[model samples]
Target: MIYQKQECNGALYQMCLYSMGTMPGMSPRQRAGRRRTTEKAKQEINRRQRKWRLMQLINANFVSGRDLFVCLTYAPEASRARALEKFHAKMKKAYAKIGLTYKYIAVTEEHDMDGEPVRLHHHLILSGAHGVQLAEVVRDCWASGLADVRTLREGADFFEDTAIYLLKEDCHKGKGARRYSTSRNLTPPAEPVRLRLGEEEEAEVPPGVKIIEHVQNANEFGRYEVMVGRIYNQAAFSAWWAAQRRKAAPDPWERLRRRRQRKV
Candidate 1:
């Protein structure tokens, strides 16, 4: 789990991530190497999911057209100036092939990634009437000799309004390919609460929070929180809180670092 630094109330909070693994069918050596790769990918996926959830919480009506949020990282051996230029060129060619006219963002940084030379790639924001296909975009990159592309739909309103959830490092610093990193202010004044999840009619009280028995359903979201105070469903709250825990946990490497620090 890689944790990004986010700012909250003038304090830094760590943002967790889950990465996706490599595709199936490979030799033993390839399998071993890819297992580690898959773990990293899984961590990234988890991170993005959390970010998406945070965005949904803050901005409910946000729509992310067809723009692609492309994030990539490369092996350290390819970090040289010439290799970097080639990689950049490859990315441009791939985008052109895919007919991406929206936005392209990239970032190449030297970081200690699993003891390997890691070059943080870029983040792309693309827009087109036909919309882009995620799988096809990745295929094109591999075909064009660029690193495998991992992109997602990053809503403008989602990323901007939920700025509080973003890593402080990603806010003003680190740039490769970016067109519009901010979104217009459109967050609603209040958040809608899901009083009743599905067919469960019985109200549940979240641990550490109170539930007003009379609030029945979402139709009275704001009414209850105000009249009867904040209501929390025990099950829903527990699940969400558990998810938060997984996100907040440190990666294996970070754990080792902590252990070393304690020993010293």
Candidate 2:
């Protein structure tokens, strides 16, 4: 919520509409009973779950202009562990020097076990600092190698693409490694709203907000739809909502009772 308030154009809401096993008359329990699991199917499910959670995190905490998508690399080290250790030490010092506090989530890809082990790098979603050049600070702290810093693009697809790219780090060919790590101070993403929709129905948002992405899917067994987007003008929507809620609703029954009393 704080992030959304700060962002004038970032996504204000993330909404989803999903239904399963209600096609005609089948219950969800019945659909589950009919479903089968395979290794590939299981892997695919895991991948989507991982990506979905990561996307939620992004959508909740990140907004345009105040967040960064960074790729951090390092000089050759003995192992990924050693390189990360050294990087953290440097970052700690840098933070102290800048008198800054921040939160971040980082994904470390696979290590080149057969090669020189220099390819170990991290992709980070980082928050900005007040009155300081965050990217330059990160670059200076990363002294060992290269730091590619970029601003967040304004759209749901950019967020989706980022989540998908980071999810790739988890698929290390069955090596069973850790996925990603986050700073302890970071806040949680928005809770997803569960709902059912009619055919071709879209996620509803107030006026002045833009729908960055809307997708729908259905099958014989289930249906899934999601709408991801941003708000450009919060003030106008607030005013409209207030006006609508305050409008009085005259009761027809009360009006009829008053008329009958007058007649009597």
Candidate 3:
């Protein structure tokens, strides 16, 4: 009886340590899951801020007539228009639920080699929802049971997987994870974001719009390069505008008037 009692106490102690994340046998996954809620909240808040800034930069620079960019990938054999229409329906619901507005980028090609040539994908740029990773938004859709989890790319690390969704070099690129690549020696385009919406502001999507969609992932076709380049060009244009704004100082007459007033 004493031996059993001692074993019970030992087990209880180990369990307490486990709950506190101090146990030696805990796996990394377990430890990560056990992180303090406050810490996780802080990290989430900061991540939102970073993502929001990206959105703002993109919007201020690249998006001129339209505020959002949406990219879609249509299967080689599929009807591109129909695929876009279906995707548009999905996107409409998504935006209504989240309450945001974005512009769509039509896909110019497919990105696979199988008879699943009927499959479709999309990329989008929009002006709404500051400070959330596009992947999180996509995952939320899956979690809501609106979409199937299988549709999402597998083995994607939810935390460090932004580069993949953003189409940038994977942190482990050229490492053992080389098998994760979809093609050979081709680095994906980097999808940077810029957010312009403020926390207190709600997105204003014009009425009579038939659909709204979020580009949760990067373009897999040849257009990623084109879109990023467009954004850079927009950034350059914005920089020029800002420079002109700065250079156009107070009217010379106004300055002279102010000087006289100061002297008087």
Candidate 4:
């Protein structure tokens, strides 16, 4: 029985390493190589997910016809967080005087140069019909530096090209700080619709939708993509995501056991 228990433990250890893309017989160098590769893959996935989430938020909230894009910058010596807070306060007061209620999504970023200090700035998408007035108010309100505001062009791909441009600077900043924020009134992304395809059945493509590009075996699950822009089945996707989370969740007792082992 003792010998059987030892064998089982060894088998479990080997299985765990195998699942992690390593094996029992790997040399130290091979193990290290695999570890680096795994870490790189994880980082790439995380980066993609962050970009996707940012795009979703922008698509859900921003209206091309109603909202204006504004870039707000601060002086080289200004504290970014404090300047942003003050800017928001001033904007609220200014909008109130004009009798306009507004919704906005703002992203803060710092441009890192070779020798100079990082230059902090903000990109905002503000919802209102008065583009010129809004621009004038923002320019006057932001005393620290320049404010550049413009109307979002009709039929322009704000969710794709514009969002990518605005977020590219700060997306790589990691999880230490929020890359973007929005007014409480902004609408959240709708839940995605979940659809499970059989091994042979192709994923549904709505009529008249152009396929921008296709990716085969994009990830571990052999995912594919058809760029229908912001028109995908959100409800289906959300349900599928929730199901995956439940499937991947660890047993509570197993988590407790691991915690106790770590304590020991």
Top-scoring candidate (lDDT): 2
Model 4 poorest 10 in a row by lDDT:
1-10
lDDT winner, 1 or 3: 1
- Model 2 regions more than 4 Å off: 1-10, 21-56, 59-68, 77-79, 111-118, 134-140, 143-145, 149-158, 170-178, 195-209, 232-264
As for candidate 2, its clashing pairs are none
lDDT of each: 0.37, 0.59, 0.32, 0.55
lDDT of 1 at 73: 49
lDDT of 4 by residue, 4-109 (tens): 0000010010000011255567788867766665565455444544565565666666666667888888777655657777777888887777777667778776
Task: Write the number of the candidate with greater lDDT, choosing between 3 and 4.
Answer: 4
| Most TM-score-accurate candidate | 4
**lDDT, residue 234, model 2:** 77
Candidate 3: segments with Cα more than 4 A from true spot: 1-58, 61-81, 111-121, 126-128, 131-264
For candidate 4, the lDDT comes to: 0.55
lDDT (10s digit) by residue, model 3, range 73-141: 433455545544555456557776766543332222223332223344544433334443344344333
TM-score of every candidate relative to the true structure? 0.29, 0.58, 0.23, 0.60
lDDT by residue (1-264, candidate 2, tens digit) is: 000111122345444444422244657764563243223333444555566667767766776667888898766743445665566667767777767555678888654434334466788888765455777877876766788998866454537777877776454645466678887766676433233345455445657667776665555444444555566677876664455334423356977999999999
In candidate 1, stretches whose alpha carbon ends up further than 4 angstroms from where it belongs are 1-65, 82-85, 94-102, 109-121, 128-131, 138-151, 154-157, 161-167, 170-264
Clash totals in order: 27, 0, 26, 13
